[model samples]
Target: MPPLVKLVLIVVIVIAAVVIWGRVMGRRDPDREIVGLTDAVRAKVSREISAGHKINAIKIYREATGAPLADAKRAVDHWFVPGQGPGVRDAAASYTAGRLTDEGRARISELILAGRREDAMALYAEATGAGSAEAQAIIRTWDTSQHY
Candidate 1:
């Protein structure tokens, strides 16, 4: 065998080993790891949740736990709030009371699908009399994905 052929063989073997190692390590139970998180991180996330900053709490939980996005969101939703169980605010609950109509929601979904997120936010805020921050937060909770 030529020298270059031996080198290529070595590289391929090393790449395969690394990929296999990664697959095994990635199989660790995320639920267990999240359950075993430190008290300090739990306290920080709790404070963020208590303040009604759900998005911030999710980001902090993700950064600290290194959990997948869905896992982080689920964990955040499980945190207890003052008056709610697991603190999971429904997407509909994010909207301003008596302001967001069913037709308005459909229009916003359409705008979002058309890649007009900013316009959608503006329209939501205008229609609902919500602040910019409130509108953006509500928008983040919307299920914008279209399914057949």
Candidate 2:
């Protein structure tokens, strides 16, 4: 093969390899990772649950980890029962209540969408609990709307 043709082919192969490798090894679901809860932390929550501690401790765990509000929501929802669904709009309300900027709300919203209703609600509770008034408001709206 010509040198230029060989070089092009090699480049294409390298790009394809990188893409495939990324898909195989990279995180496929940001929402499922339970942001801020290391395996160690999760193990602790498990132990606590096994020991009869309140399951809500996990939510507190997400809050303490300093994960983004939205991520916290996603994490809690994943662990919580009854699957109240992601309360992203609620979190936004809380964040707004706490006086977070539009950028902050947008960030949390994106995180909420990264998963589903269950995860989103947990994050929303965490965000509002952390003092996002806007997030709280969103939750109230959801509660009132009967759509959540």
The candidate scoring highest on lDDT is 1
> Where is model 2 more than 4 Å wrong at Cα?
27-148
TM-score of each: 0.41, 0.22
Q: Considering only N, C-alpha and C atoms within 3 Å, which residue pairs clash in candidate 1?
A: none
How do the residues 18-126 of candidate 2 rate in per-residue lDDT, one tens digit apiece? 9989755553344564456554465454444435554455555654474544555566545532112353232333444774455544554555445444454456556
- Model 2 per-residue lDDT at 142: 32
lDDT of 1: 0.68
| lDDT tens per residue, model 1, 30-61 | 56545445545665676677678989989778
TM-score of 1: 0.41
